[model samples]
Target: MKRYAKAVWHGSGKDGSGHLTTQSEALEKNNYSFTSRFTSTAGTNPEELLAAAHAGCFTMKLSFVLDEAGYYPERLETTAYISFENGAITASRLFVAGIVKGISLVDFEACVLEAKVDCPVSMALNIAITTEASLTD
Candidate 1:
């Protein structure tokens, strides 16, 4: 299966504005600009989208890993922090919290590690990927 998104940009890099659209149309001509990317402007940027993808992918992969390890999570939450430096992405840090019955914290952490390394998005990204996981009652 293949997924695709489209970006349309106009003008110079610093002064240009763009809109993004996904195949699913979840983002239909969403706006992005230099200020939105470089400063605290109200718009979406590529890093933000990538972070969302990473977080979603990691959490889903963790759920599968937990299931395979015989642990059913009542809830799982993950936040992916993408760091962009020197005009490139430097790292993705994942913070995850899960509530799963009958699972030790150590085991939960192991599962998180496995998912962190095995998620498609993590594998696709060339930057450093680190994770911090906690098991919550």
Candidate 2:
């Protein structure tokens, strides 16, 4: 299957502005601009969205992996950190902390690695991806 989003931009580089929207309306007319991209301004940027996508994808993938492994999950919290430098994406770091049932630490770590590597978003991103996952009591 294929998924898509829309982005529209106008004006010049340092002072320009844009908005984004997804097919599902998850982001409707979300505003973004040069300041938002480079600094800690309001609204969203590409890196923020990329991080969200990675986090969401990894979380879902982990749920699937846990279910398939005969484990029930209460929560899987994932945070994705994407670094952009020198006009390129350097890396995407995935920090996952889960509250799962009926799984050992070793097994859960392995499953987290599998999800990190096998998730569609992780596989599609052309950047270094790393995961640090743990189970919380």
Candidate 3:
């Protein structure tokens, strides 16, 4: 199976701006600019989009792990941060918290580690990936 996405950039990187549209169109012609990334702005940016994608992908992978372990988590919350520096993306951190009905900590840790290494997005990213997982009532 193959999946693909496309991005089009126009104008200069510093003073000018561009829009990003994905194959899914979830971000149809969304706006991006240097200020939105380097400074503070009210529009979207590459890091933000990457964070969203990582969080969603990690959560989905965790769900599959939970199902496979017969735990069936009640809730899985994940936050992903992508760090960019020197005009390059450097690292990604994934924080996950969940409430599960019948899973031991040992089992959960094992599953989380497996997902961290095996998740599709994790494989796609070309930077360091770190994860922290916790179980909450």
RMSD of 2: 0.9
Q: How accurate is candidate 3 locally (lDDT)?
A: 0.86
Which should have the higher TM-score, number 1 or number 3?
A: 1
Query: Please, what are the lDDT tens digits per residue for candidate 2 over residues 1-137?
Result: 76779999999977889999999998999999999999899989999999999999899999999999999999889989999999888899999998987788999999999998899999999899998988898
Clashes of 1: 0
Question: What Cα-based lDDT does every candidate model obtain?
Answer: 0.96, 0.92, 0.86
Residue-level lDDT tens digits of model 1 in 25-122: 99999999999999999889999999999999999999999999998999999999999999999999999999999999899999999999999999
On the 0 to 100 scale, the lDDT of residue 68 in model 3 is 87
Q: Weakest 10 consecutive residues, lDDT, candidate 2?
A: 1-10
The TM-score leader among the candidates is 1
Model 3 TM-score on a 0 to 1 scale: 0.90
What ranking emerges by TM-score with the best candidate at the front?
Answer: 1, 2, 3
TM-score of each: 0.98, 0.96, 0.90
Clashing pairs in 1: none
Candidate 3, residue 35: how far the Cα is off, in Å? 0.8
